[model samples]
Target: MSKAKPLSDAQPTQRKGAPLPTDPGQTGYGAPPPAPLPGAPSTPLTGTRQRGGARPVGWNSPSSRRPPQFTDTTPAAPVRRLPQPVLVSAAVVGVVALIGAAILGYRAMDTFDTVANPLANPSAKQTEVPLAPPRPTVTVTATPVPDAVRVKQNGLYKAGKVAAVNCTAPAVKPSTEAAALRFYQAILPCLNRAWAPLVRKAGYEFRPPKVVLWAKGQTSCTGEPTDVAFYCGDAETITMRGDQDSKLFRQDATSGRIHAMDTLAHEYGHHVQMLTNILISSSSRKGWAKTEPAKLEESRRLELQASCLGAAFLGANKTALGITGQRLETWEWQTKHSGDEYNPKKVRDHGSRKNNWLWSGASFKTTNPASCNTFTAPAAKVS
Candidate 1:
């Protein structure tokens, strides 16, 4: 687990945020950004591997959905608008925020948001540069590995089972910056502990990726002054705001812990993909860039998988985190709102709020990584 780092005017950037839901239709955060006005340059985004026997061979799949696709033509993220609730709350937020209220237009917003909008606005943090690609893609195949090992056919779908984790909840005021950092610091190790078992379960040699809580400036993935917590495979790090704003902060501290923990766990899920070899293989799939619709679908699969992996970890460790009764209810409600549907854009990146929560619900219910086999689910499930 990496420690917190403060950005300076001269320091380079990295991108990923738990953003503020600023879009008109957004419920919480994690919405697809506006399509570049028209002619903006595009960005590309990876796949998965294994250990021991079979090397690249696969086992029976969880679903029989058609093969997932891949692409390298993700368009430049569009400008984002501030949501009503966030706008109203901003007036009373802390004065210590180095970032200011979201600028009107697509120009700049000091921070992004949480949970749902982890990678929502790439361009939101930076003025001209686009956010990095959203995620890798996946296709389905219920059959055994047919000579090659593809993301959809990877053993992680069923074999990469997650062991129950025992998380020690860090006590803090959920809405404060100090609290955010403390919680993140406390939870990352738990996440590492939770997901590390997948390597042996799936026969992959896996290790944990660094998790960074950034205050400002560019990130490896987005190159923006982003607030959303995103996983950057390039830097092999997850960059998020030390200040927890977003719907998570909107709740009482108890509820906020669930959201904050989930946010960090979600980014860590991307690390699971990297170790599993799903991230890179997904991109190498044939004809991944054939259509924009397919690209969005692929992004959804990648993100939704992260959502499920995170949920499985948290759910299995609910007792340790004190997630029961109302606290559990808070998590369910928030996830339902964490989707691309909230963004109100024609292009959806992270799937709908309903699906986002649904996938999370599906995983936690069983606490099984196999339950997160989005790679084999039909299009409707991922969407």
Candidate 2:
């Protein structure tokens, strides 16, 4: 033991599996390595030793020991702590929020559509709903019309030219009565049809009048004597004696004779008078009732007007009623004869022969009722 002389005096040397010591002023192969720690200065140099110096043992600290080599088993780095439950909860919460938002959005859309556009929801509107208010009811009444003459009892009559005959004994017969009655009913419609437009134009609704006939030597139920055909303005009725047929031997040509047709036509004209308010208004005028000279002329003019209106009714529809020109000639003759009932010059004279012929001719030529106005026409023209 060379008396390990004095251990302190001698320099230490590295041993196997041991780390070399470091000096402050001395350097190793490159820069001087770090000083070994007090503990484990060379704890395990079993793997590999530094080529030039002693080594430390810790892996993170700077060590002189060779880096530990592993067969890919060492963890590459400290694993990041992953809170799986917390992450899963956060993801689920986000998805739940999105679903909630989607639900809320759909509900908002539905509410907007319903409130904004009601008509777009036909199905919803179709459902029964309360009404705002109820409806009201109303009623109406009608007026009664007058009755016309029965065609069975009284025969039809027309306006026509004929010679006065004795209808008293020989002419009285049931066949003639039946024939006259048939003729009246058939011809009255014709007269109405012809005058319908005139009356309507004059602001009236034309209605046919009643017709009644009495046989020869018979008194009317009202005690009137058998006489010529007459229109009752009061009852709006017509009364004709059977004996008058002898006096006026006129009748329908095709159906019976020209006389009966003319009689009914005249009576229908009277009915037109009533419908138009002409008879009442004209006859009741202030100056009309007075018995003055001019007033008498006015009466004649009034009657003449009635005559003209009658003629117009018959002649307006000549072609449609199967009236030939020859029949028109017969009409002129009839109007002249029948118009004599009123004296044209007297206060009551409707018209004279000249006036009757002219009025009838004017009606035959023109369908216009305005043209038949006898009031404003020249006296000469009226005649």
The best candidate in terms of TM-score: 1
lDDT of each: 0.64, 0.48
Question: Worst 10-residue stretch by lDDT in candidate 2?
Answer: 5-14
Q: Estimate, for each residue in 1-383, the C-alpha lDDT of model 2 and write its tens digit.
A: 00000112210000365665555654443333555454544454444433344455442344345433333343345558769998999999999999999999999886776546768654455548786676676676666321222111111112221111211111222245555555455555566555665556545675667666655565543465533455656677655443334333433332223444445555565565566665555455415445564555554555555555555555555555445566656655655554433422222345556676676567556533443455556656533
List the candidates' TM-scores in order: 0.57, 0.45
Candidate 1 has its poorest 10 consecutive residues by lDDT at 5-14
Candidate 2 wrong stretches, greater than 4 Å: 1-175, 214-226, 246-256, 286-288, 292-295, 320-322, 336-348, 378-383
**In terms of lDDT, which candidate is strongest?**
1
Candidate 1 residues 1-383, lDDT tens each?
A: 11111111111110685644343543443423234335433432222111121222113222223222234345545669899899777865754243443333234343445444667743335559776888888877787443225566666766645666666666655576666676677777777777766655777887777766665565446464443567787777877655543234654565556666777778787888888777666544423568888877777887888888888888888888877898888777777766654452334767777788778898887888888878788999888
Model 2, global lDDT: 0.48
